[model samples]
Target: MELKQVIEILNGNVLTPSANLGRQVKGGVGADLMSDVLSSTQPEAVLLTGLCNPQVVRTAVMADITAIVLVRGKHPPAETLQLAESEGVPIISTRYGMFEACGRLFQAGLPCLERPVNGE
Candidate 1:
């Protein structure tokens, strides 16, 4: 799914990186803890989180997530947005909660990533 598709699916507002709407999203992962996200998220996945902090962007960078969906209408601080912008990651906000946001993306055909081969 493209970032624009995610925005349309969640009725999300792009808080930053409006130019990144064309970027492709390969999957979605919903998590509140940055450590969990860093440990498990697949590259190019969309991160669905309610944690409104700069660390969210840092985690996204570590995980190589293409976009972030701020669930429950949560808004990150301006500094967070600035960090995301500098990192070239798009930040989107939605009124839906985490579960609903994940479900919406999943139902729209954005599947999660499978475990890596060979049990690396």
Candidate 2:
């Protein structure tokens, strides 16, 4: 789904307007643990999390995630937003919790990453 559609679905606020909202995200991965995100997320996926830190942006960059949605009405620090913008990653904030946000996206046809087969 397109990033614009995901934003609409989640009722999110665009923290970084410079991001490519037209880009398509193939799937999503909701996790607060950066390690799990790094290990599980797929290329072009949107990361849904409550972890509002610069590390989240760094992780997104390392994982090639194009967008991030901060759940549960949480907002990241200025530095985090700055880092995300510099990395060309869009940061979105949503009132929905992680589970609700994930469910909404899933219902809207945004699939989640599949678990590796026996840890690959």
Model 1 TM-score on a 0 to 1 scale: 0.92
lDDT of 1 by residue, 1-120 (tens): 889999999999999954479899899889898877877777999999898889999888888989889999988899999999998889999999999999998999999853344577
Q: Which candidate is the best by TM-score?
A: 2
What CA root-mean-square deviation does each model show from the true structure? 2.2, 1.3
TM-score of 2: 0.95
The digit string of per-residue lDDT tens for model 2 on 27-54 reads 9999899998887778889999999989
What range of 10 consecutive residues in model 2 has the weakest lDDT sum? 111-120
Candidate 1: residue 99 Cα off by (Å): 0.6
Every candidate's lDDT: 0.88, 0.91
In candidate 1 the C-alpha lDDT for residue 110 amounts to: 97
Q: Which residues of candidate 2, in runs, are more than 4 Å off?
A: 117-120
What is the model-wide C-alpha lDDT for candidate 2? Answer: 0.91
